[model samples]
Target: MSEAARHELPDLAAMAAFGARLAERLKVGDVIALEGGLGAGKTTLARGIIAALGYTSEVPSPTFTIIETYDAPPVRLPIVHADFYRLNDPAEVEEIGLDDYREGAAMIAEWPDHAGGFSHEAACLSILLETAKTGRIAIARGGGDWLGRMP
Candidate 1:
């Protein structure tokens, strides 16, 4: 059965730490769907993961570009950071060649619902982020790989 893990990030540092931890467990073909409203730290979390994986320089948001690809060596694994917020139709995901991007690469997708959702995938991890008085709350849920190593 699938399970959920909740984390309270009191600050940006805490969120980055959490992201780093999650990055350690990532593998090829894994999908991390980030769901949150504006300014919810989805991009921040993605930056943390990319940085932790050995990526240097800036991590750009895919808001306009739709998808940003990062390869190995600079990063330990190939990864794609994508945003579907601008998609007018769910079918637009096909135009972006999402499956091609996922081949031997982990994916971090924001506004996944706009891309028809990734939760049905057995290896998908859904992270719901929300603002709170203290900082931010992150709830992760899904099956496949993360079922055993969740915090």
Candidate 2:
């Protein structure tokens, strides 16, 4: 079974703080699978993670381009930020060379289900966001590799 943790995102600031915590433990080959309905904070948390990674510029939504990459110096490590919302099929992931972009890098994947999902990976940290009466809730889960790493 996967390990799981819960977080309360009472506000954007809290969500961003959680992102920073998540970033501290990030490493190569890790995949942060973000899941939720539209406007449920998937992209918001992703932006937070990117920002915590040391990316100073704006993080445009990958809703159009599908994928965005950030390298070292600006970021502590290489990262592939992908939004699979535009993907018509899981096979499209291959066509776009998703694996190539993931080489030697961590990934922040939005709409991961559109790309066949990444939860199968031991290092894949899947975060499911749900809109709450007040703000939002984050449910994070992972495999053995994330046993003690679930933030």
TM-score of each: 0.96, 0.97
Top lDDT hit? 2
Please give, for residues 1-151, the per-residue lDDT of candidate 2 as tens digits: 3756899999999999999999999999999999999999988898999899899999998889999999997999899999999889999999999999999999999999999999889989999999998889999998667887779
Clashing pairs in 1: none
Q: Name the runs in model 1 displaced over 4 angstroms.
A: none
Scored against the true structure, residue 88 in model 1 reaches a CA lDDT of: 97
lDDT of 1 by residue, 26-50 (tens): 9898888999999999999999999
> Model 1 residue 12 lDDT?
91
Q: What value of lDDT does candidate 1 attain over all alpha carbons?
A: 0.90
Model 2 CA deviation exceeding 4 Å by range: none
